[model samples]
Target: MKHRFSRMGVRGRLLLAVLATVAVALIVMTVAFNYLLSVSFRSDADDRLRNLALDESSRISISNGRVTLPQPTGEIQEFGTQIWVFVSGATVSSPNVEPNLQAAAKSLDGQPAQYLDVPEQEVRLYGVPLYYEEERIGTIVSGLWMGSYNYNLRMTLLATGALALVLLLVLGFVGRWVLNAAFRPVSRMTAEAEAWSIADLDRRFEMGEPHDEVTQLASTLDGMLDRLAAGLRRERRFSAEVSHQLRTPLAKIKAEAELALRRERNPAYYQEALASVSQSADQMTRTVEALMAAAQEEGSLARGRASVWQVLEEASASVGVLAGENGVRVRVEPPLRSLYIGVERDIALQIIQPVVENACRFARSTVILGAGRNGKEVVFTVEDDGAGVTEEEKDRIFEPGVRGSAAEAAEAGGATSRGAGLGLSLARRLARAASGDVEVTAGRIGARFVVRLPTG
Candidate 1:
């Protein structure tokens, strides 16, 4: 499967990837640049040391199997300076005694001449083994301080460090700017996508460049939105037409039934006609209710301040007669403290009544209505002693028309599922309208539905 970044948001992942790339590049650059700078400085230092040793080559003498050096006193020492010269033979007395010259003389290793730089003082030492026609005489040693070359290397390193810091800062800012600019089209597309709603789906996303990926995405989304908007329009138009068309026939049927009942001599005929008329009226009422719920769901709620307790009381009172008829008792456990919040009264009432009535319909004996504080929100739970929904059905239980296959086996007695199968669907929409949600509780023994509403 392709890699899916399901955890982090798109913007976060993009920024993280960009920053990581920049960080890796910066580290590699710093290391490589530092190494190159160090090598260059070291090469200059070595060259200066060698040149100093070669320039002083003539200032050497040997006599009596011993080496000597010219005395250059009172010389002002520059930075990184060091001087060392020692005797090559056992004799120490000489015309000009070289400091630490014996150390360089011992480093010959069978060579005629050799040069070494002293680490402590940055000084160079040259050892020349004196030879006359393959006969060993003695060695002449000379030393020169290299303070200037050490200072050069130090200054170069300091400059390199400062330049590297400035470059990193400039590159960091530039990289961020370029990245944001490069992704501007994507950002705009996302914002516009978020703003699109069912009411405004006819509006299309403005494409920047047709060949670009972002533009292609915008074109595809616009086409999809067009199809969806057309489908919704067709659905709404059909629903309204059906409702309008059925109204006249339903009115005629009800009126004729009432007229016949008034004129009928037989009491049985009157009762049967009235029952048929009442059933038709109930079906008409249910159809209208479904349409109303669908229309309301199409638009966002006009929120206002209202009391949670008051809405709950109203819903309970409305469903009280239904619950009693089904032999289900409902007891509301009012909150101990006065609880209030902002919400639409009608929507809230619509949401709760259906849930309570449905619970009562299937309730074997008792239906409990309970409300309490849930942190910053208020929660209501409607539970019944009926056969609770199974785990599989729980997912689609809120879906319209979905019910327990055993719904016929329940206490509802052969009555069809309530109100166009919109009890749960409408309830959920209304709950969301109030910045709330409805959830079906999963358990082994009972039917339970929980509703959550924000306190503000």
Candidate 2:
């Protein structure tokens, strides 16, 4: 089965993308908000400076092209050197002159009305020529230092940046926690699967109530587990059936062979009878070996590193004699790469033999032994061009000693069949032991047995 644990999948990727987008947007908006706040504060300061200049400009009077100031108000006095200047053509009087104002004054002399912004001091200086009776006498200049405004702006930006950084960090932590919580079910499923073993095949994953994708996945896994448990039960019953069906014949052969030997009458008859007994014993031994291999497969103890394609080739080689006897040819499909995983060779060989033998028995022309993958699972298929099984018998074919009408008829007609109806049952049992399964395909053309195994 292909699970979500090894992959980040859609949900995790989407969560990460959303978090990144939110963080970027929050930072951009925070910076813009701080910048706008600084501009608003600066605008208010400029408005105050403009009003102060208007109020103080009227206090100064011009006489003989000279500027003079009356006693300034207490409110104006508090401003100290941070003052306003009134200048005429040859007279200039001020409560203040900045160390850098000499250049500013000369620059404003030729201009009747203008505003200049100085980069060095972060100030906006306005020089307006004052007039009485439409005759311009001198100019009035005002200085607005932007130091406090700049300081406030810088602080605001720094504070907003810090807050944004903190919030992003907090959000990252919260996101990680939320993601972990959201994936709790998946994590639980992983832990449970990891702890699960073949000895406790009946156990199943507990599903949650969310009924989302995770729940759906759990439900699917549960269904698979149910099938596996049921298959195991069927295999157990099949094993018992094989034992019952084969024991009586073996006992009869043993008794008859022993009696013929004891009588020691007709040397030729005795020799023939002894050979027949040996044949029976050999057949019985092979059957027992097959059964033992099947059991090992069912126990999942047959797992070792083996190539699937090589196994199929070996099975084909083993079935060659039987295929010839039944007038059947084995065809191996191309592009079968030798991929190896953990699986016992004996178990794999035993599982494939009976399937191939049965295919030869029913096949009219050819049997193809092939292997492929269905997603992450390895699939081995034995397909024959013969009379396909009927729908009614398809489900019962893998039950030990439960032969279908055609197979039974072949047995009754003295065809010297090798099977006592336990072949497929044994095959399925062994396949399951390797964490794999066997199933009859749904097609109507021929008999097909497919074995599915996990790659990991």
The candidate that achieves the highest lDDT relative to the unseen native structure:
2
lDDT of 1 by residue, 136-236 (tens): 55544445555665676577667766776676677667766776786787788779778877677567777755787768887888778888888897576
Give one digit per residue, the lDDT tens place, for model 2 in 1-456. 235534776556756676788789988898789868977976776666666567667777667756677543222224521334544554355444445664675576547666676667576666777776687766666666676677878887888888888888887778878878878888899999999887787787777553788888998999889999888866766576457434533654665577786865788887776776675566456556656655444575445666787778867765655676678999988434656545656556666767887888888889988887677677888898887787898779988777777777777888665467777886776777777778887444688888777663
**Worst lDDT window (10 residues) for model 1?**
75-84
After superposing candidate 1 on the true structure, give the runs of residues whose Cα lies further than 4 Å from its correct spot.
Answer: 1-20, 48-117, 124-130, 134-144, 183-187, 190-194, 265-456
lDDT of the structure predicted as candidate 1: 0.63
Clashing pairs in 2: 297-433, 302-344, 304-343
